[model samples]
Target: MTETIHPTTESANRYLRDNFAPVREELTATDLTVTGRLPDHLDGRYLRIGPNPLDDPGDQHHWFLGEGMVHGVRIRDGHAEWYRNRWVRSAAVADSLGEPHRGTPGERDFAANTNVLEHHGRTLALVEAGAPPYELTHDLDTVGPCDFGGTLPSIPGRPGYAAHPHRDPGTGELHALSYNWTAGNRVAYSVLGNDGRIRRSVDVEVHGSPMMHDFALTERHVVILDLPVTFDIATATEDVPRLVRPLVRGLLNRVIGRNPLPEPVIARIARGGDAVSLPYRWNPDYPARIGIMPRDGDSASVRWFEIAPCYVFHTLNAYDDGDTVVVDVIRHPTMFATVLNGPNEGPAVLTRFTLDLRTGQARETGIDQRSQEFPRHDERLTGRRHRYGWAVGFEDGAPGDTLLRHDLDTGSTESRRLGAGLEASEFCFVPNPDGTAEDDGVLMGYVHDRAEGRSQLRVLDAATLDDVATVHLPGRVPAGFHGNWAPEGADLADV
Candidate 1:
């Protein structure tokens, strides 16, 4: 059973305060402090990106909205060589900073503030919901928006790129599911080959314009989420004043019981008022469905299975198991609820869903009932059965987050906590250069210390969940979104 958890939320603009606040200085520090012995096998930069607004949006700021900033910690020959921070120069950011914008004819020139990745020898900062990725240089400087060398198809004025794209470990192909708000209820599947060009593209129709942060890729199928949360017409129109919000909410609840109205339905009935214009809401009226489409099939070949209404921000991994496809993901009860400034939804738990292709039935099982999010597995086992996965845990009454490692085969979990007032972000597993077992690696991520007003890169033994190393950074890196372990010379083909 799903438990009801209402976390003790901070101030409405908590993101603008403390470690969540944007770092103003773009400084470079060399030969950084290392608390423990750095591993010899690691030789690359630990890169992560998040929304760091150039100017405070104050009360109107949403946690997920803002300009993007990329932070990098270069590790060379087991030494912390350098650490630097740079802002991904979107048109808005470039103009604010008095820098030159690079990308020409940018359709939707917005911040790529979710994730940073390297593709086809080019580093790109990415965002979801209809924005092209901003390419970056080796030193983490923005190189403008990239459209796969203009081969990326445009929804209108610009090509859409998703934040989370799964790279097939076996085939070296990158698969992504991108949705545009104006696409009329259809999501596109884009597959990039070894050369980072779109090798295959397909449009899959969905019920509503659901917020798809991540998807699952099995050996035989591409799993797509068509959930209840979708776009609202009222959010699109900016004419609704804030003074009439109570009146509008009362009228909307009376008619639809809090479920958001589609564009067509609201166009005929009502208008929306300003409440940060969140656009997507936890819509209970819309039925939740998951589409299991064959790898070589089109939209018509998809098998839609109705499931419970919930939201998933990140998926751990998925693979085929006999006649069923098993997908592990971070499940949230609802999103954009309670507060529009950030994701103050109920506790997010790690859940496993098993879809029986033979019977067309879907069943879900809770793995770790404790509050956890941002689950990641071994990329080497991307489309194959895996034994281990790691996630960041948010236990009630605890001051900081815990890093958890789950062994699916043994039904055992191990956890690592930084300290009393230090928070952890998504931990990425880096496999050992020469290892026999799957768990022979180190898990690395950023840890923000509230008391000290600083952050550090923590490395833990993946097998034992013990601290292996810690690089004390010069400044605090906010508890941000996803990141990866980019070892040197491996980024070109390091999907």
Candidate 2:
């Protein structure tokens, strides 16, 4: 007989009361002060060098401008600081690698590899590489030089090295996946030995384009997702007299800003190229999501699955039990809607699926509130067993925005609603070490208040979903993508 678990009256009542508290308390306050800006000298500059003029721009070096450097923030004590990367030169000797270097430091490029950091115990591992190949130290504070070994491979059209590394729990191997952006977007996988040496490289084909966005790995698989291409349409238009050029330019900018690519160009590219050719239109088979399952030693197989029709941004959480793989899918609307209409209308969904590793089948398990979007899933406390855990997502509903939590086993959910002018992102859970069975885990996330213009890190008891503490920041965190928590004394915090 199949077992069934229903939501208890007490549990329902508690959820009803606290469902909105996560967004209502002082943690949602937007009042913030601006701290000092990041040092301008630390910015990394890049040059376009390829066959296509607009696509490559040749030898002319272009600065990405460090003014918009602020993206995410982490805090300890009352003090808060912005997260930025330092550029370091590649050197064979340790002593030769210290501090102040020229030509945009290697560390800056390495920092661009990951949207956020993930921590395994105290050891923090991040995927780093840019125009040049290099791995940035995930250490919290102290700056160390970036390492690219020798003569890193380049991705054409795009000035960067394509290397993203993640740890495989089953084999305990650090695998780095490299792509040649300049040469038809080919991918190569290299294993990082325990001694920090890179093994042989094998070239694999996925597609040819810098449109790739994010990827993940499981005990038996690796997943890759590609983004749509961007086409500038304003350049192709009827010629106008000198006096009318300014007016035409103004109108062109407005239309291009809204639709980005013209209808004709979009059609031409879609027809000329194969599946991976055009950057727009979601393909059912060439999923925005790609998953690879490891089989025996070094060999692994790949699987591609589509979540939605639009651009699906994802965060992956894997379970050791081998029966499940949970992916958080965030749907990004077409450029036309975003640029013209703004962020008010687009909807988002949080989808969880159970993958039968042996059978090669993926089954959708549960979904959170549909009107809500931008789901951030974290399972830092799952450990060896995957039976019990918590997942979180945000819902932008009519009443207000809310945070929703899902219970894996019971398939029941709870949501906390926030009042007007508030938003939240990036949810992480900190587990207790003693192994005592009190509650499941501890919940932590960043709450942003647009009205007051600020963000706060809020912690709560995972079981009750009650606020335990709120760490206020000195300034706005400018909205970030993903984050991971390292237990106290983990190597990740030392830097």
Candidate 3:
């Protein structure tokens, strides 16, 4: 029997009410129907992980905080074999499983609900704040917390890892800017070798506990988006005393027959007058600044550049041109600035920042006027100049039924519409083993059709933005954050 979960009045917020609501069923299905020819050489699993809360959150709910559930599909020898979904068993999840937590404790607890990628011959489920990575098999089963085969370095009070670590394709080294929510004013920059051992760790100074979701890598530097979004525990609790506010509201609404307070008032309370918590808030005192540290140097050698206040959740790509650094990113006006459950600002569009090191100035420009999110590109050319970029296109703040492709060389774009009521998730670029061009491979992603109430896996030609194939799924796949293509040999054997 498949269990279905629904949104409750306990939290009358946006994230828990519509497409963002969590699904309750766990399923494993086989031999799904295919709409087009599956490539013969494709042999791997395409997996994605995102937040799915198991317990009641009520009004304190934020999209970034929740238990993680991973959905995957397997393809082999030109056939769609199986699809599976599982919750990452953190200590909290393990308790519900009648087992104990499996890893060393960090300053923050584990959720593993963000991104899944293969590193050092092992697959890892990762989150941003404080948990160590949860290792998994190629088949998507948990293998406990991985300290990189017992070689990843650890600090006394900081134990968090960045979800979007950049792996240098040239040197086979992984680079990450790890930060802890509790450790204010300090962050760590660490590098791991191809052998899965820590190579170097350096502490960088900052103003407050900023939520640095993702950074950018260039040929010579690691660009940091040290913007205004910060962590404030005290303010987060001012509006809604986790225990008292809900009870008071419940009594007034259920027992006294009151209609409850306005959402703006509720939002103000949830923010404690100011948006606070590990979630994130825009800081007015701290000016938005961009810093660049030499990949082979320390924080003391870092150069800082200033920009207008804004929030950036993800960076598409960055490269050095002569004495200036060019970065492409998904730019938002402000994050958590209003009372809405999610971002209340207008749509995020693609923009480029040119940081002139010689003059210490930064200039912003538009790359594409279309509103979009989840920008991605060919990883083989990461930190280097590439010809193409891709993102899930959006109509408003909601997902649009199309995927966009940008040609850097000619400043042209192409859109591949997924029919009328279908929406695509963040997709991965899988390169052809024998292809030479960067855009020669296919783009793979999950698509949900609202009219049919089902989801499917789609494959599109990267060069032309045309549908190549699709595999219909037996169950619903909720929208998610990030994922990667795990090839056949990315396992312990490769290590």
lDDT of each: 0.77, 0.38, 0.76
Higher-scoring candidate on TM-score, 1 or 2? 1
Span of ten consecutive residues with least summed lDDT in model 3:
252-261
lDDT of 3 by residue, 1-495 (tens): 433333333446656655566777778999978988878878888889888877656665777777888889999888889998887878777787786776654434466999998777777898886568888776677777777756554433453577888877788688898876544566778887887777787878776667888999998999988888776444444466677766544432331111223444434444454331345666687789899889888878888999999889889999999999999999988887663355547778888999998999999998898889999999888899877999998765767788999987888888878788787889889888789999999999898877666788998888887878899887777777898877776433221
**On lDDT, who's better, 1 or 3?**
1
**Weakest lDDT window of 10 consecutive positions for candidate 1:** 1-10
Query: Which of the two, 1 or 2, has more lDDT?
Result: 1
Number of backbone-clashing residue pairs for each candidate, in the order shown: 0, 26, 2
Query: What lDDT tens digits, residue by residue, belong to model 2 across residues 1-495?
Result: 312212123322121112211111111222322233222221211100001001111121111111111123333333333332232222211223453433334322322323333322212223322334323333332233223343243322222333235555444445555542232434555654444445545544453232343445555445445444222223222233456556655654454322233344323322332121112223233333345534223323455443333454443344435455554344454322332211233555555555555666656544554544434333322112333334444444212345666664565667665457656655655554443653455655566665555555665666677666565553344333345553334433221
Q: Residue 463 of candidate 3: its Cα lDDT?
A: 86
Give the higher-lDDT candidate: 2 or 3.
3
User: Of models 2 and 3, which has the larger TM-score?
Assistant: 3
Off by over 4 Å in 1: 1-11, 157-159, 239-276, 395-399, 491-494
| Top candidate by TM-score | 1
Candidate 2 residues lying further than 4 Å off, grouped into runs, are 1-145, 148-180, 183-185, 190-202, 207-210, 225-310, 319-345, 353-366, 371-401, 418-420, 436-439, 491-495
TM-scores across all candidates? 0.89, 0.56, 0.87
Model 2's TM-score against the true structure = 0.56
Q: Give per-residue CA lDDT, model 1, range 1-495, as digits (tens).
A: 322212213535776765567777786889988877788999888899888878857666777777888888999777899888888888878888887777663646777889887667778788988778888898998778888867776544122678899988877688998876656567888898878688888988777667788898988999998887776545544455667545654554443322333444343222333234556767788888788999899999998888888888888999999989999988888876565666757788888899999999999998888788778888988979999999888654122568889999987888877678788887899998799788999998898877677778888899998888899877778767888877667744545
Off-target runs (Cα >4 Å) in candidate 3 are 1-11, 103-107, 150-156, 236-279, 490-495
